[model samples]
Each structure stands twice: as C-alpha cells, then as structure tokens.
Target: MTGMEPLAPLATAGRRIETAIIGGGQAGLAEAYWLRRAGRECVVFEARKRVGDQWRERYDSLRLFTPAWADGLPGMTFPAPRSSWPTAREVADYLEGYADMIGGSLWAGVRVDSVEMLGDGSFVISTTSGQWHAQNVVVATGSDAAPKIPEVASQLDPGIRQLHSSQYRNPAQLLPGPVLVVGASQSGADLALEAAQAGHETWLSGRHPGELPVNERIAGPFFWFAQNYVLTLKTPIGQKLRPVIRHGGSPLIRTKRADLDRAGVHRTPARTTASIDGRPTLDDGTVLDVANVLWCTGYLPSYAFIHPAVIGPDGYPTETQGVAADVPGLFYLGLVFQRGFYSHLLGGVGRDAKFIAQLISERALSRNTVAA
Candidate 1:
C-alpha cells in the first residue's frame, strides 16, 4: 500500500506475481529490467535500505577494473572516461540510474528472510515487509554477503581495531598506528597500498598475486590464462594435465606488485593462526606489531535463507548454471555461472538476464498453450 516516491517500501503481502527477483544488485536489477521488457509481473527485493549496498559497503577507494563502457546495461551507456575506471560510488549511482531507466518498481529495503516452497509449487518469500508469492524466484544476491573472517580473530585483544576489507574505507578512519592487512587480493592490495601510502606501517600478509603491467594485464590474456593456464578449466585432457592450484586462495583480479613493492609492505608468509600476543601471532609463530588489522580474506555465498530444495549440498543453488533443478519456477542469476561466460561481472549481467528472461518467457508461453 502507498508505493510512493523513491526509498519507500511497498506493503506487499500474500499476493502472487509472475517473478520475484531477489537482491537488487546488477544481476537482480538486470533480470527485473528484462522481465519488465517481457511484460512479466515482477518485483525486486533488496535487503539493503538502498540498492548497491555491496558496493557502498566496499572500500571508498574501490574502483572497477573494467571500464565504464563495458560496465553499462544492455541499452544504457555509462557517461564517463570510457577507458578509465569508475569509483564504487559511480557504480552505485549507475545502478540507481539503471533502475530509474527501467522504471522504479523495485522494493528497496525489503529483505527476504526466507524462501519456502509452498505445497502448491510456488515460492513463499518471507521478507522484512511481509510475504510475497511468486511463480519464479531468482537469487541474484551474488556472493560476499558472508565474509570469511578467521575464527581466531574474535579472540584477539580488544585494543586492536579490526575491520574486514568490506568495512574499510580510507586510512584516516583507522587507528593512527601500524596496520596489518591480511590476504593480498585486489581489495587487500589496494587497502594495503592505501594504508602504507598514508604513512602507516603496513604489513601485507599471504602470497599476493602480483599484478602485471596494465598493458600486459588485458582481459584477453587473463581469460586465456584462467582457461588454459589455471587449473579451474576442466576439460577432457586439460583437467588431467592441469596442476592442483588453489584458485579459491587467490583473487580474481591481480594486485599490482609494483605498487606493493613501492609501498614497502612487509610481506609475511600465509597465516596459519592469528593470536594477539605482544602483537599478532602467525601460524608460523612469528609475531608482528599491528595497531589495526584489516582482514581481506574472502566472502562466502550464504544461501541459508533459500529454501532447502532449491539449495544443494554445496550451499549454493542446485541448478545447471542458475536454473533450479528441484524447483521448476526457481532460478538463479548473477551467480558465478548463471549464464554466458561472465555471469558474475556487470558486463555479463545484460547477456545473462536476457537469457533467463527468454527461458521464463518460453516456459510461460508453453504453459499458456497447454492450458488453451
């Protein structure tokens, strides 16, 4: 009731719709856009008060590696220095703009507490607002809702101001002392660099994937390496030939080695355990003094709220690249392998969304024909 101006939540209830897309990030928003184009009744459920909470919660200095030109929706073009990277704020703004262009039907601030399958083969989404019934549900929240912090981190001394990379913004906000940045992913590297450059004694832990020069780090080489070079590419012969490399242990993006080397960040071995002695204890028993600790470990995909049947044993949705198996009307988008080759990236959302929308359209049409 009273679904008025922006930043307002609609009082949705027991009513049913053709599609209910969860998480208003790129994937959720993209699917909603395409569904609207398909003339399907749909609504977007965003857990955050506003859209793009993920981006907003990220480090203030965070910028997309991909250019703004590659970051636009299907039709809309992001106005900017095409080749230059856009800040996290720009990304949030662009998503908001995309929503506006798609016409604001999204219900922001509505958090889906749980999605349960009803006896009649529909999804009952228990949200912060109320219940929503939908024939199809898309889990587009992506990963990173669950940040994997060390279990030992909680036992550290209270004097240590600790924060995850997700919470880190700028160095000015951190305690004015030495900072220990853990996990040298893109986020970790960027944060470490920012901290070190800010005149703080920063120690970057774990083996960092040193970034190549911008000229050498093009997307073509990256993909080729990931497919042909890395071990993730499972093939008839490649799987057998590939080494057992820990892909999960590294970041998708490279951390510029030149920047880190220039920053003089003390590189420590990969941590086994973290304990607060005089300083912080590593698995190797070496101690490092740190006034602040920034853990950039990684994120976990939390599908705990998803209905059990929809989720497989892996804690991820059981589907062939985002199509739910146990549940007919259930779908997943914006995931790692939802569709196309690049489903998780902003550049891939438009392509994946169109594919999912077409499938939904075809199914609905087929049902209508059968009924007729």
Candidate 2:
C-alpha cells in the first residue's frame, strides 16, 4: 500500500512495521507528514478517539498565546487570520483537519501501554489494540503528559472544591465563594482572571514570571525569528537559559499582571505551604479561607511506558536532538528544548520532526541496501 493509505487492521498477532509513532498530537502528525513524504510505512497511534482531542479537552476559555501565523504544522497553514489568536477548539479542529489532509496511517483510541527494546534492537510496543514490532519508534508525546498537583492539596478540607487546571473548564466548576488559584504562571493567571471576572473573590498565589518586554503584535516577526532560530540548544545563551526556562514558570504571554490587578485578583508572591484548619496557609503564615482551590501548577513528564534505561534521572528521555542515545532507531519528538527553545511549539516542532524523519529514512535506506 502507498504511504498515504490508512494502516491495515492488525491481526491478533504482532504486526511488524518500519516505524511506529506514539501520540498523534502536533509532533506526531508533523513526523507523519515527513515520513509519508519519504515513502516510509508508519502508523500514528493516539489514545483519544479523535485527533486533536487533547486540545479540545482544554478549558473552554483557553486561547493560544501564539497567533494563527505561528501555529501551523508541517505542510498546512493555519486557516485563520494571521494575527488572530485561535481558541482551543479552533486549534483542535485545525489539527483534525491536518490529520485528514496528511492522509497517512492514523489510528485513534489506541493507547500505548509499554515500549520495550529487545535484544535484536527492535521495539515491541504493547498497545490497547494489539502488539507491534517496529524497527524505529518515535515517542512524540509532548511535555504535558500528567497533571501536577502539590501534595499539600490532600490536606485541604474535602468540603472545598479542588480542580486542577486540566480539569477546570469554566468558573462554573468552582464553588460559590472565594477562589484560591495556586501557581501564577500563564495558566494560573488566566484562570484567576476568569474567576475574578466571574464575580468571585480571587486570590492568586505565586509570583508572576514577568511578561514580554514589548508588544507582541509589533514584535511578532522578530520574536518568532529569535525563538525559532536564535534561542536554540546550539547557542551558548540558549544553553545557559535552558535550565532556567525548564525549572521556572513560563513568562506571561497574553495576560499581564496589570490585567489581573485591574480584575482585582489578589496577588500573593508566596507559595501555599500548608493547610491549617481546612484552609490553605501561605509560606509567610497567612491563611486563606476559600471555598474553591484551583491548581494551575502545570504538568510533569511521564515516561513510565518506555524502558527505564532510556529515561534520564530527571525523568525525561536521554536523547540528543530527538534521537535516543541508548537505543538505536529510538527517537523522541515534541520535547521541550529538544532542538531549541521552540522545539515543543506547534510552528517549531516541524523542524525537529523533519530532522528525525530524515535520519529514520536514511537508516531505512541503508538497511535496504545492505540486505540487497
């Protein structure tokens, strides 16, 4: 079958393929595009029933920080005004459409369970549907694999409603009293502003990570160029800034601290360290008695499905520019700083995908030649 054709249904037994990509998000879809261009046989397995369900699962009020011009994948341009910031649903629909346009082997609702490298260097992937033996495996799962909630959350009174940012859709999900939003990063600030606007007494705990120095609209092209090319792993400045960006909260993009202040969001530049008498207490000994606690604390990378040896001590894959160092034919995509600062971003991920796809294609071609 041609590369554009849908992958055939697998038998009860293991199905062997040239390449298997895990996660059908932007990264996986980008890789699929390039692989298809190279005439490679591959399959993209996504856990959700439909492509872009991940984006659709986000909060109702969520809008991308980047403009439409910067959100396109590999071949297709985002179908919106260049300056418009697309909503979560818009991005989701765009992704679904991109998948349809690519016309490759995409299997939805199939969750990958495990990825184990055998003695022969081939990977045996266990999935919800069946097993597959792949010569090359690309782990394109993005950074936000699992929601990260502080352990102190368990100590809060069960009477108070608690919702992680991932589970938060609208202010309606909150209790009818004061709302305490923990973590003042992009997500936290957005949620706090929403709660305050919805007429709730909002307390935003955590320091602001600062904002872009200039207006994004005017500096759009320059900023995009810097992020896409300049602030990369290859440069000394980018290397120095990598750890800081990875550990620190992401700087506010669309929402500024002044906006939150105008909305009357009480800003607390301290962490919520404890729960005292069923109330959240700040590190400075201030107690907040709130009916709803929203956690915008962000997420943690989960590599439990992959072999432990391939993962680093920091709980991420040990790879160089998406290629796994420990295992041949094993690669990663959509990782933060995988190639550069924008490696995980939609417009930037395609670059990394193309690089990995080229390597995979070259290796496949070499194998074929040796066999001949």
Per lDDT, the best of the predicted structures is 2
Residue 289, model 2: Cα distance from true site in angstroms: 0.5
lDDT of each residue in 203-234, candidate 1, tens digit only: 88877554444542385346434432342223
Clashes of each: 0, 0
Per-candidate TM vs. native? 0.87, 0.95
**Model 2 misses residue 66 by how many Å?**
1.6
| lDDT of residue 165 for candidate 1 | 81
* Count of backbone collisions within predicted model 1: 0
User: Per-prediction RMSD in angstroms?
Assistant: 4.7, 2.0
Give model 2's TM-score versus the native structure: 0.95
Question: In candidate 2, which residue pairs get closer than 3 Å at backbone N, Cα or C atoms, i.e. clash?
Answer: none
Top candidate, metric TM-score: 2
Residue lDDT tens for model 2, 1-372: 234655454445377899999999999999999998887888899999999999888999998767889989978999999998889999899999999998757889999999999998899999998898999999998878999899999999999999999999998888799999999988899999999999999999998788877665755665578778778998998887776576554577777888899999999898998999989999999999899999988789988888734677656788888888868999999988787878888788999999999999999989989889
Model 2 Cα shift for residue 305 (angstroms): 1.2
